[model samples]
Target: MKLLFLACLSPKTGNYTTAERIRSHIESAGHSCELRDVADFHSPSDLAHLVSQNPPFEGALAIHLFKAGRLLLDLRLPFGVIFGGTDINEDVKDEQKRVVMEQVLLKARFAVAFTEKLKEEAEFVLVSPDSKIYVQPQGIQTEVAEQFCWTEFLRSSEWHSKNLHNILIIIGPKVDPALTAEVEAVVKRATGVFLAQERSQQELHAAMKRCYAVVNSSVSEGMSAAILEAMDLRVPVLARNIPGNAAVVKHGVTGLLFSSPQEFVHQSQRLLSDQELRERVVRSGKLYVEEHHSVKQERETYQRLVDKLHKAQFLA
Candidate 1:
């Protein structure tokens, strides 16, 4: 079966990585899955034209409900949806987007949330039934560039650090500009802070491996892929205390959570000064990722979903 996978494909972002990973999973099951950036299509008509083009897609899957799943409505093909961070958390607060998302959920054959908290939120906010929603945590995988040097990276960025612990703060494209600017302002006051922007996955992984700790200051998340990747790479994480972050980071166990900018600084200092705490969390974090976010398990889950879709198609 040929499948069409639609997602926000911003360069060097989590959604793009996820779309690619799921595409690989579908393809591994002997299906041809075409990944297209959701930004390219403006309306349902645009998607209809693409679907009408050569060979046609037997099934479709979209990452974000309103952004991608909206296009799937009234289309002939069967489709599924995976909730994006903002759609469930921030976007639903808006009356218009909430209506659209509710419609999308109603029409979708299935929907996925990365965490159980998100699933419950979606069901409560969007009034979606439990039977339609599945909780499939994002899979974790990391590969550091063999030749990448931390010193060279710092040099390229014109950052000169003398034995100071390197703390990485990622600036994702989807984050609110005001919130991002505020977070940057606070984090930059600390020593050895690297504000990473538009880095390839390899570079991000390499930096995470060498950094003293990775920080997530986002106001909301759909299970941050970076936090999971940081854990998989054995890097300690310091995340903002949001429901999404809370779902993954068990305070002082998997990672530390901070409720404010001041707490983030305090936690950073504690993690850096206390080697025993750092080692314990890093070890437990890695073990957690291995047990809960394995690539093989993720692949199998999607494969099972695809097979179910295929069986439904055959019966139809």
Candidate 2:
């Protein structure tokens, strides 16, 4: 079968990771898969022209409901959608996008949400059949570089030894500007907290090893890859207590959860001062990722989803 996969393939985003991973599994299953960045197509007509090639695709898969799913609305082939953070968290608040997303859900043969909470939010928009909306956590695998010396990296960057115990707040390009501003304000009032922006995945992992604790300040998420990465690296996580963050980090067990800037500061200090707590959370977090978010498991699950789609095609 020939499949068209549409997503925002920005080099550094989670959606890019997801689309590429799914494409790999689909192609490995002996199907032809073509991946196109949604940025390349302006409308459903543009996408239709692309898919209308000689021997057109049998099916399509899109990453974000509002962004990529909207462009595939007019597709004649059976297609599925995977929800991005904004679709359920931010865009659903907008009346127009919510209405359009409802129509998209109705047209879709299946949809995926990273968490049960996300599935619940999507079900409210359109009462799709239970089997259509799947709650699958993102699969993750991580390996810290053998030569990664966090202290050396920090020294080379000229950070003070006094601040060596500082927290690392990773700021990605897609994070909400207002949330970023809010986190920045919190950072200003706190001591020994710094933002680590613009580093590649490997570099970020190395940096995370040296930090006292890593912070995830996103207002929303679709199973944050960063959180999983931190867990895999044995770094204790301190995240904003949003539903997305909460889903990944189990407060007082796997990691600490904070509701406000003040709570975040308190938790960071507590995590730093309490070595027992830190070690316990780090141990539990590593185990959780290994048990639940294995890359192998994720690959197999996606293969199953593709196989399901193909079987339905055959039945039709």
Candidate 3:
């Protein structure tokens, strides 16, 4: 399959990570993928190219919000949207933001969200009830620590002196550091180190297994790749008590959640103290993540979605 994939191609964040990873997947399957960056882009931008030219693509994919995809509506191209968290969580709130998103979805042949909550939101908020919406968690390939030193993850922050106690917060653009500081302060009673704004998803996941727990302080997410990666690595998670995090945590089963800073601190202390409890959470979390969030399954589902859209558009 040949694909003219459209997304923000800049690095240093999750959007780029996702675009790069999936672009790799598509190429690995023997498809040709042309990636474009909207951030470094200009007006009458790729939008004009998509609208004016007859693309050699079977179907197109729009992977970012704002400028990358807003043009697809006018092009009337056969494309699918791989929605980012901001599109559903933040952009849907403002009237202007919502308008762009609505146009993107309405023009798309299908839309993919990484979680059930997000699928519901897409159905209710931006897309037609009949519009095809798919739920596929972002896939992760787990790496066990062998040659890599766990100390390297800790060395920079002097985390060993912090009692080998550290919390990892991997940030993208929408991540609120205010929430990060609050999470840090709450976990401080336990005397743990809180490291913010990690460089890569692989590094963050590796650290999740090394740390006692992983903390997700984001107020919103489309299904956090971090949360699933943490659960898969069996580190146990302490996350915000919100829809995106809640869909995975299982509340005291896999991990705990809290409404306020104090409550989060209370749960963190409880998990720290109870050895047997923490072990149970880790066991259940790992099992649950593998069963529900397999990358192999997700990619296959994605292939089927692409085939379906292609058939609907140009084949059938």
Best by TM-score: 1
Candidate 2's TM-score: 0.87
Candidate 3, residue 102: Cα displacement in angstroms equals: 1.6
Q: Where does the lowest 10-residue lDDT sum fall in candidate 3?
A: 166-175
Question: What tens-digit string does per-residue lDDT give for candidate 1 at 212-291?
Answer: 88888878788899999999999999999999899999999999999987998899999989999999999999999999
Error of 2 at 174 (Å): 7.3
Clashing residue pairs, candidate 2?
none
Better of 2 and 3 by TM-score: 2
Could you tell me every candidate's TM-score relative to the true structure? 0.90, 0.87, 0.81
Off-target runs (Cα >4 Å) in candidate 1 are 151-162, 166-196
User: Model 2, 190-220: lDDT tens per residue?
Assistant: 5544554555666667767766677787777
TM-score of 1: 0.90
lDDT of each: 0.84, 0.80, 0.70
Model 1 pairs whose backbones collide: none
- lDDT per residue (tens digit) for residues 53-76 in model 3: 555456678775555667566554
